[model samples]
Target: MKSSILTRPFYYLWTTQTTANAADVLYIMALTVLVLNRTDSLVSAALMPLMRSGAQMLSGLIAPLLMNRFKLPALLLLSQTGQCILFLCLALYLQLNDNNSSLVLVFTLVFIMSFLDGWTVPARNALVPRLVAHEQGLLKANGLISVSDQVVQFAGWGLSGLIVAFLGPGHTLLLTVILYGLAAVFTLGVKEPPDVESVRRHTAEDNSAAPSSKWHTLTEGWKMIWQMSRLRLLTFMDIIDMLGGSVWVGAFTLAFVQVALGKGEEWWGFINGAYFAGTVGGGLLVLTLARAIGNRYLAAMLIGMAGYGILTALYAINTRPIIALILVLLMGPFAELSIVNRRTLIQRSVAKETLPKVLSAQASLLNLVFCISLLVMASLAEWFGIVNLYLLAAGLTLLALGVGLIGRRTFHNAADPGAGD
Candidate 1:
């Protein structure tokens, strides 16, 4: 099974993605350190992430135009290569200037790099189905990717500080450049199957049937999601989930530790570590049971969503720090189950040519929702207290689960031909 599923193309894709993800973590850390060192203000440091998110959101909004024109491997390569060049330039600029005045230039480079990176996720996801030899491999492939992502997240944050402390931010940025370059090289080795040509032909035919315009291209994915009942529900659930998930951002988690658990930063770190640990476990579990879960994706997704919601609600009400840690740890597997299945469903639900656009539209919407959700969650925490804010998040998750329950039949029927068109 492993031999069949882990084809050469898939191996290249996985390695490319994993290397790029690690580079992302290093880049963010190095940039944050640079910003803080130059500006000496927490607010200034925070702007790095804000700008990255804003740039990525804008990029996602316009990604369909490029996706329509370029092949997935080319897009992935372009994104990585562009980021590598920009990051190298940024590092060189900081090295040459050695002054705080270069901060503006630094931010501009970061935003541009992030804009390019916005193409990576959707392109990567769209390419996965093409790279894998069999439909059954999708689950295992996604699970493997998820596991790597979680490991990166877990180790990246924990070690980035130490890496930066040891190597300094400038050197860290240089290291990221190397990673990006390697990723670009790996991307060059990824070869999509011949069926992708047929997908492109079909897309070309559809394009010829209609009068194409920038507005049509931009809104094409949105229209598809709205018209397709299955996609519509899935996207709606995603929005709700993002809104709820925002409560787990660093600031809110810190506040929760201080207010509810009466713990310090260490506990906050512990909870996060536990959550990532759980996610890794969950990914392995899914990988082991890929065939069984793959057969009943919707059912598994619903169960996962239900478990996550119930655990979230319980965690919100709990005051014990240890229990809170355990609850979040438990939430990991459910989160992974739902996330992996939903992503797999999205990849399988749409036509091959259409998947990138659909994913781009969904990514844009989720990014916007997450940005707004951060502000909303912050305000709620200030007004009603952190506990209530979490309760509200739990409520949102449950509401999303309710939507899944209501759409169970629609999701199942989505397997039919043209059901999600």
Candidate 2:
């Protein structure tokens, strides 16, 4: 049965976000194949994720101030509309002479598209609390969205590959624009609270905090992070792990087909689809584990994530395509656990008034790490090869294990309502 709290806007947001995320994967894939075909340069190869990270960093830098006045829904809508325009331009370029074929142009388009996309995500994340009506509602709401996101990706990627296979990149880019337009329309179903509370909060936060000058507002999240040690630590750990994960993202499907198992591009789609499918199962287990054991979330996160790390390492070097695919599918069992615990920890630790800014800061920081990681990983992989990438990642995973030991206990006690008090 549908709860009234899970209203029409909620579903619309979920579906539209699904469409948005799916389109992003497709766009990346399209750009990847196009670049590979045009230049075959590994530096160019790394440009896609680097561009995304750069875009995200730019947004992350200014989000605290920008979000200070603009409510979440408006920010999200603006982002969606902005992406549509960026894609429309790219589509037109493709329809014109030689698709420009300039790596600079390609890099710029990805940066623009991704930059616009980053604006909305923090807003959407900030708005989650408003959508849900209670404490338990928080976990349930997050869990449902996680599950939906994974499910959407599982199917969306397969469909994206088919669209690319038959229609070609030009048509795929155009279709992405169309999907963004649809997302924009659906976004209209969302009603943002008029900028009252947001404005007041910003004023109060600024005035109460201290005298500040130039970009101080922009980097306020750093202040918040310093003040909140546990959060700072958690965000730092995420950055390190996310750096390792950058190669994981940049090369996963591509590696699965080309290097790991020697399957073709089409089989690569199957590999990603299976892994995302596992994430759906993973998200469900996250909810189950949280409910079954309240503060024991850390143990689940450690075991699940350590297991996921092992599986990813195996997938990196394994020769058997079937074995690799099966291992990846089973990866959800742990990935979900780690993610749910992370979110829960953040939610419990951060104040409601500052949640949006805090989230933005953390997201931006991780993404910055992601960009550097992508650059390093691509260079190293090109030089040292893919097998070594896994060995390096395994070492980072062990580092995360140490983090789990020290930080796990922190999150359990960090959520005291009176801590900041």
Candidate 3:
């Protein structure tokens, strides 16, 4: 028989994530349109993502406390259920108020819903190793998840416009509520292994022997990252890569298309579409090569980072629109290789009980870094020009590659699951 990881429970998890992700895209699109219509301000529309990110960052910071109290599946269920209920309220409010809906109340609901949703990723990741019977299963599992996410991203944006166009923002939000409800239902099927639960229980007991303060619970993940050598290096490289990666955000990418490629919004759509296509392809590639990559996770990550950096540099200088599209499409697989392997490494680098807290900390740091990068890169683009801005991003990626190179031995040792621990 095949492993349980490939069975019903994992499928439930996958379906829950897929539906929830779809709901996320739909709600964001609907909200942005609603805000734009109501406030007639681009700045107000933009504030949606900013507010979501801020709330999620705050959520990640405090997630450890909840992780300690609830099991991973339970935490996931809570998040999905909470989002569903909040979205229902939002939908009802929109329906009742019609033209007079308050943006303040809308944004407040968005923030709280986002805060509840923040636990999903960390909890899901921590559950993966528990769900899998073999260590190598992680590569295939992560690849599967990545592929689904990329597919959702590729199709979601395109479809959401039509959805909102037909149903209007209010009705579209009602659709989103349905998706969230489906996700919560599927989340109920995810179950942890008995052995894993026992280990977590023992770990909790050990920790409870000491009087754990709130401050310590909050900082536990941060402290783990600081103390673990491999984790520290991986996180540093992740920070640099994230800083560099911010160039691909919608506004910056649009700016690049206009300034460097001399193209318009149509090309912007093509570019985004191509990048997601590439990521889907990359995810498939990782799935095909899961066994081989699992044996040399560190090497694959380094190569991926290096290739992405090189492609980014070439992309920055090229003036041809066709070539720019190709470069970004090619950048996808390399980006996925690095991202999936690094995530797998992080999962394997710590004990089962500690993984959620560590991941929460890392997620918090990356979210904070990404927000800052957006601002810093926007300023650099303003000061140095669009072409030079991408070049700077490429330089940051190479710097990340350098960090990985410096810690090669440590990463090599960590290639085996649980080796670093």
Give the number of the best model, judged by lDDT. Answer: 3
lDDT of 2 by residue, 1-421 (tens): 7566555666667777877887787787777777877888866766777778788878877787767756566677888888989998887788784555566886887887787777666667676666665455555666777887887677766677688888888789999899888888888777643454666566756655764643666666678877776677667667667767765573645864787677787677667777888999888876665556455545665776688788878877788888877987998767887777667666666665567788888778878887787768878887877877876776686577678777655654535431321
**How should the candidates be ordered by TM-score, best one leading?**
3, 1, 2
Candidates in order: C-alpha RMSD to true structure? 2.4, 3.6, 2.0
Candidate number that wins on TM-score, 2 or 3: 3
Worst 10 residues of 2 by lDDT: 412-421
Write model 1 residue lDDT over 1-421, tens digit each, in one string: 3558668988899999999999999988888887778778977876776687788899999999888766788889999999999988877777777664478778888889989998789888988888887888988999999999999999998898899999888889889999999999999998877789667656656665775576788899999999987889899999998998888877788889999999999999999899999999889888988977756777788888889989988988899999998999999999999999888888878877788899999988888888788777767787899999888888888899899888877865745433432
Pairs with steric clashes in candidate 1: none
Whole-model lDDT, candidate 2?
0.72
Residue 28 displacement in candidate 1 (angstroms): 0.9
Candidate 2 — which pairs collide? none
In candidate 1, stretches whose alpha carbon ends up further than 4 angstroms from where it belongs are 1-3, 201-214, 414-421
TM-score of each: 0.94, 0.86, 0.95
**Count of clashes, each model:** 0, 0, 0
Native-referenced Cα lDDT, model 1: 0.86
Task: Indicate the residue-level lDDT of 261 in model 2.
Answer: 73
Query: Which wins on lDDT, candidate 2 or candidate 3?
Result: 3
Candidate with best TM-score: 3
